[model samples]
Target: MKTIAILFIAFCSTISFGQTEKESDIVINNSQQDDTYRAGETIHVNAAIQGDLVTAGGKLIINDSIYEDFTAAGGELFLNDYIADDVRVAAGRITVDAEIGDDLVVFAGEVILTENAVVHGNLKCFAGNIEIHGDVMGNLDIKGADILIDGTVKETSKIVGEDITIGSNAKFHKEVQYWSSEGQMDFKDSLVNTEAYFDEDLGEEKSELSLISLGIASFSLWIFYVLSAFLVILVLHALFKNAFSNAVEGLQNNLLKSFGYGLIYLLGIPLLIVLALVVIIGIPIGLFITTIFIFSLLFGHLIAALLLVYYYKQKKEKDWGFWNITFLALGIAIILRLLTIIPFLGILLSVIILSITYGALTLNVIHSKKQFVKT
Candidate 1:
């Protein structure tokens, strides 16, 4: 289960990378793509986007309008434009300086909503430090280390943090509830609409229901992953059936070499990335390699399963056809996921097998490319 969670996080990282940081300093006049997939070191926009805006980078500054939803993740994100739909973000530092017609959800180290910021719907924030000096017409939910609200919230608010502060101009026209560790609740009466509720042990309390909910959530997430892997297998099989078959064959023929190389590659990459970071010129190369590594982690398990299925069929009386590969792949995926429920051994085996598969796939691609060059 933990393994699956890690893969999911890695996969989401890839998606986030594709959306943000992938495209740097892109400017759109009045055009719209079906969807925005961009990542780069820094992003600066002075135009409008029609479709869903997805971006990641070191820094993002938008000064235009988005017709659809906006999603971004990076080191720093600053939006001074109008978003027609919801805004979802995960970043190191984020600041919204414009209006969002829908919800604004952010997970960041530090989040600030400047006075120019306005949210027509709910504002949900999870951060290390959050200060809202803007206007939210809907409910506000904040979970962080420190929170300061000087904004006007027309609806209720729920806050959970270590330190919480409400500015004199902060307006909560409805009910306000908070959970804080400091237990300091001295505020002017005019700023709060109703008597606020503060409890030190509010969110920290654990109950049987909470455990059951967590169990259910974990099971659901595992099932979702199985389904996603099956989908990926089907798509890859359909598009690259021959290539996948060759990769499976390569893994079977060179299992020991692949495993050794996988171990070395896994351990060596971080060191290389660190060295690259020390040399600013190698930053792009480092990021590209990191992206490839993330993709390998995502596809490694499925590829290993495929290779396993192929290895078993080799010992069988008859091999399955292309059409049957999907079913075979799905069966293997289910068994592997079920094995994840066991204690540490199951996940450990998965890691080793996936690493071997990643190495095999890398070698197979290199060999193919070399053959093409030779021809």
Candidate 2:
């Protein structure tokens, strides 16, 4: 019986990933043409994507062609295909190939541009270490701990790092602007115009100014979001407390499944809308349905998050404290919002995780209500 229960849960987990028309859980490979995705225990992409590709998992590999842009936020992202447009990626490790028509912006722990890779535009990166051996038609703007460039940059280059290396084969057309941690500047290679900035007075002054500006902006945004969220939660605290608590619980219990759901919806809705155009009446319906799905998914995630917090309280055998839940819930909400900015897959995965958490919590509530009626 225990094994059966475990197997049943596992089966639900598997089915949850491949669902197309389901609500509250992850939906994978939902529609037809131009977009293809499979969200299961993990996400595997082995097909062509005419549009953008978004996925979330421990590892994501795109060994196929992407006609449009590709954005991913996850642990490890490997793209060994042809992407016609820009590639914006945020991950732990990012490897890119194929041809990109526009600029490539990446934020990761480690970034690599292999030999066969080609980019028609600029390559900007923020990572711990970046190694480029590919061909970039424009400048390479890199900010990281260590940067190694063995590729071709058709335009100027600006690099800021603790350690910077411009390999022998690496060619930069215009000038080189570098910022380093070492007090002294090293101009090892022959260059037309090479300018180096030290981390002392000049860099320090600029850094202070930039930091102040960033801090102000960040604080303002935070305050606004916090206030808005507080007002909403306060108004509906009684009604939404349970729902919110359940959503958080779901996230804690099944974060990956929630992510899988996001992977499905983020990539599927557009494809469905395109299919809906086959019949004129389907256009409005499709749009409306997509909007509802997106909203519901977001709401569900919020509810799940709340539930997770409440579950923790129950486990500890402590009284439910509204202030504690409120504070933590708001914090999580803010963090999730920040996660959404991560390229294509990040936003979608966040949505999926939240939706599953929220939906499951809602179901529990409805069931409990029904049970009360029987009593």
Q: Best lDDT goes to which candidate?
A: 1
Q: Which stretches of candidate 2 lie over 4 Å from their true place?
A: 1-32, 35-41, 183-332, 335-375
lDDT of 2 by residue, 1-375 (tens): 122222322322322332222222233333225644322223556666777765544456777677777765555678887887888766567788767878898866788899988889898886778899999898878877777888777787777777777787777667767777764666556353554444444345335433321113467656644544443233223234444444445545556665555455556766887788668989887765555554444343344345556667766777756656756666665666566657897666665555555445444445456656789
**CA-lDDT, candidates in order:** 0.69, 0.59
Candidate 1 Cα errors over 4 Å, as ranges? 1-25, 33-35, 39-41, 205-258, 261-339, 353-375
Can you give the lDDT of residue 181 in candidate 2?
Answer: 74
Q: After superposition, how far is residue 181 of candidate 2 from its true place, in Å?
A: 0.6
| Residue 80 displacement (Å), model 2 | 0.6
lDDT score, candidate 2, position 284: 81
What RMSD, rounded to one decimal, does every model reach? 9.4, 18.7
Backbone clash pairs in model 1 (N, Cα, C under 3 Å; residues 3+ apart or in different chains), count:
14
How many collisions between residues are there in candidate 2?
Answer: 20
